[model samples]
Target chain A: MIRHPHLRLGALLLTACLLTSAAPLAAHAVGGSDAAFVAATRGPAPGPFLYLGAKHMVTGLDHLLFLLGVIFFLWRARDILIYVTLFSLGHSLTLLLGVGLGIGLNSWLVDAAIGLSVVYKAFDNLSGFPALGLPRPDPKLAVLGFGLVHGAGLATRIIDLGLNPDGMIANLLAFNVGVELGQATALALVLGPLLLWRRHPSFLRFAGAANFAMMTAGFVLIGQNLAGYWLTTGAG
Target chain B: MTEAIQPMSARRMAWLLGGATALAALITLGAVLPAEFNRDPLGIGKATGIAALWAPDEVRIDPAAGQQPAASAQGGPIRTLEIAIPLGPGGDPAGKDQLEYKVRLPRGGAMLYSWQAEGAKVADDFYAEFHGHTLAEHGKMTVAEYRKVSETANSGALTAPFAGIHGWYFLNTSERPVTVHLKVTGFFDPVAPGAPGNEAGLTARVGSF
Candidate 1:
């Protein structure tokens, strides 16, 4: 097959981006001292909040890869809006409820589930299970469900801080808003380049390679989180 | 006319998938390898050492009024006493250390007090208070007015100006250990010679103010 040169380059760049970014995400989650430093310095300061929010979105390889898969096949602006809104709503609701109600869960477990979400999306993109003769569940519901788990994972660190109840509700809402803004910013940065690349014929040829990269990233996330679960809780 | 391009064969697709999977597995295994072999708890020895400093060899609590019978120094109404414990030595293992002074309250009277560390950043920055206890069964006082306060009076990363101030207070109920555990995590070097860090131990006693 004759490949579009631009699409091939975009695919290669995407793979490199995913692999390089995935390392730090997995490394810190598995207990790097730097992670502890970041945790300790987190406070109500607007500057720290913004920095943390941006870092969180950028470092989150699973979230970014999932967004890539979601938008890959979408040609219309409206579809992107619909899917991102559904995900945003799902995440916002759980982030508020989980922290406000003090509903704590094992962070490692939640993160592992998040890793599975990445895998699920990649498989869906590849039409893997359907090819094997299994019924595929609705993608929208799956996105929303995974979105809740992702938000819960974000809440774990805040819960560990034992934040003062004074202004906690307000602060949490602010943080959630910041998270959405950061997500929107990342989407623009990533998908703008992606949409342009899709105009090239190579997009079709290299789509599978992109999906393979996403799947690899998902597996890496799973392995890291599972290891953390074992080390911290002695659970799988 | 544009020629239609051929799709990848199923075998090629499988190879791509398999290779990606194997690569991911290897990366993950590599990530986990360091943690698996290095099983030492991150701060276990340090924490144990800190805990050990407060393990009571002996203790005494004197009443300020001197009206009541002298309670056993082992554990009683803690007004004033002498504490001998090792302080920090300059090193990398040192963190932003803190000393926690804990006082168990007597049946009716709960003690309320604060302290300042005389010569150390870790010590001078120490602060605590206790209150609110009514005697329960067995004449054992449960802490009712328990308030934990921290030093917010000073600033600067390299210097602790309030180093030699009082450290902690308590209202003793049971004759258990009125323990003070100082966890040394941070250090400061004086610009002048014969500065503190000259002594390796901290001496601070809790008393009613």
Candidate 2:
């Protein structure tokens, strides 16, 4: 059973892989009964929007991938807080301004950028900079920038939903708060096992493989989103 | 032990990137492309069979082709048929409960149509859809939905989107009996009640939205 640690990591990665593959079928947007709610609803619905936001974060493989990559190697609680807060701040900014001011961006393009962000995180985790003979990027600034891009991705989805401006601010704030809460819950689940796993001697041996697998998942995500872009818009 | 601090060789980095890229490409070909666009390349799609996941549902054509008018070339009296469809018990919310009365219209032909449902006993909303569709040779159907709504009465002008069967679907939402009255004037073929043993064709097909 001592060999099961690698198996556990394999399960985690396989789950991520399956989820990432399945997610591209329907991009991160509202549909089905939720779409009916969004279309039929007449006025303010902070509670439902909050719930949806949390739900989105919970199921959003792209968001979870970036989160996992961000906290992969970090051991310090202070660093985790700082980086997560920065991401939250950046994410909340565009989600507010984009949806509030009715800023519009193409959803697939933003989603493609979000996918590329995952690739970036995975590459960074692998310490690819020195190998590629390039200077490393500052992790904080990188997260903030990608976080902004990620916010635009979220904004693109909400905007595409045709969210009515009535009480839009309240609903958006609720959604952002829900996102943070969901992130915290997900972090707890991921970090506990990860912290435990990091204490093992095999952690170093397997770290490279884990990052490589993550990079593969990210690349596949990018391909899927780009394919979505082409299929839905161009090359018809 | 100190490989983490070592500057990795270009050869090793190439192997890592190449292997990951190959894996990503394989996944995209096998699952992503097929499930999304049904574009199968490696026959992995045939193995996984996710290509059919996004296939467009078809509208079935029963052998009950309605009678064709003699003066179908126009300049004839406006073809009019009135049907009083009685809503049966235990209606289908999936549109199977709707009586689909279809008329074949030539491409670009204009058809004026109207329908109303009486509900003295039932207070439910009257639901119907006006749509036109044509079937391709290999079972692929191209459908253009004109209107779908809940109203007791509706009157509209419909220009045939293509050379195809176009008509109204009257759905009974409640168990209470509702009589649907319909009138149509157009250049088209008639959709008579039943053509032989096909009793199900009497209650034509209304697609669920």
Candidate 3:
């Protein structure tokens, strides 16, 4: 509408590349000063844990990609709120219970499941399931189900860090609150550009191409996680 | 207002799905597997020079991992070093001219060190705090002060209390600039400048004795 649709599309694609390319290039593990902070935390350090939780959610590419896929097509604010709430509810349950009970799954497998959620959402965006003569699952239920996997993935990382058990409840609660804060922040960032882009007719025209790219990203994530699993377990 | 979807033909959808899967597989084999896991099954990553992207610290070789020895009792081979710590103008009592230097020592590893300050008018014109700290855990640091005093020179021997960093925080308190020459013989590694845990950013001079 303004001019130079090709340039706009190129810019959008470039942005996508920058965002998704970082996932493979960077290790998903927590390290650096953050790891030091986690290791050095003693008891009841809610403020720092909260900050860490928020930081993790914001920087997490797997979570971001899944969120993007989940919201790519939804237009109504009410629907967005409902879907996001379901996701929050699902993830919160596992993040709290899994860590509290000291239950852990292989981090790689948990991440692989998270990647599969992205793939599922992207495929649904393309209506690929229906095209295959499969009954489409309720979007709300699917989001919630995948949210549980996402939460478990987060829990695995926290568990790996060996957080102190003293005042665990308060710290975990603070972290959860921080995660929600981070989710809101990330949602705002993602939604703003999406809303602006939706106004352009190019959105509809290139929607398929965009979704295909998302699907590819999802696969890359899955492959990376599975490879991590295979290599770490020495199953190769 | 109409956000209804347009369905692709079954054949088109199948092709796109297959194409996406194939492309993703190619990328994973060519890039992610090599860079993240160090397993380049297809060899394309090596051919394309993508495997070099794997940082040395991040590359984990699993087969020998369990069999590898624990953190070394001594880092590398024994070494001797003579280093200089210097301060320029304004190196005065306001604590402006401060520098920290450290060496990594394994638990119970010993080092004999002698350091002398020159250009200071007297012993009181120079100050140093010799200390050691355990690697931080959970953001909490445990510091052991071996000595904290003001003097122009000191000679000491230390068997490290823990496997961590032991160092000197030197301050030239005289209005005139002062330089301190330090000599050490020991089983220790000079903490590299700008490395993690080298919070002071003081560069080490690696003159062998």
Candidate with top DockQ is: 3
Off by over 4 Å in 1: A1-7, A27-51, A232-236, B1-19, B35-209
Report the C-alpha lDDT of model 3 over B1-209, residue by residue, as the tens digit. Answer: 11434777889888988998888898888888777667789998799898877643322122212332333354456678787777764444555487777788886777888898888778778889888776544323456677777888898977776678887888887778888898877888888777634655666656543
- Alpha carbon deviation, residue B101, candidate 1 (Å): 38
Clashing pairs in 3: A39-B137, A39-B138, A40-B137, A40-B138, A40-B139, A41-B138, A41-B139
| lDDT ranking from best candidate downward | 3, 2, 1
Error of 2 at A176 (Å): 1.4
lDDT of 1 by residue, B148-191 (tens): 44542222111111122112332222222223333211221111
Model 2, span B84-186: residue lDDT tens: 6666543656544567777777765767777778762333556787887774333256677778877778888766656777877777776666777777776
- After TM-score superposition, what is the CA distance of residue A153 in candidate 1 from its true location, in Å? 0.8
Q: What is the RMSD of candidate 2?
A: 10.2
TM-score of each: 0.54, 0.66, 0.65
Q: Each candidate: RMSD to true structure? A: 14.7, 10.2, 10.1
Give the lowest summed-lDDT range of ten residues in model 2 chain A.
Answer: A17-26
What is chain B's TM-score across the candidates, in the order shown? 0.24, 0.54, 0.58
Please list the residue runs of candidate 2 whose C-alpha ends up more than 4 Å from where it truly belongs after superposition: A1-25, A234-236, B1-7, B57-209
Candidate 1 lDDT, A50-125, residue by residue in tens: 5555566666667777777777777788878888888888878877888899986787778788888887777677
Q: Which candidate's TM-score is highest?
A: 2
Give candidate 1's iRMS in Å, 1 decimal. Answer: 9.4
Q: Which candidate is the best by lDDT?
A: 3
lDDT of 3: 0.77
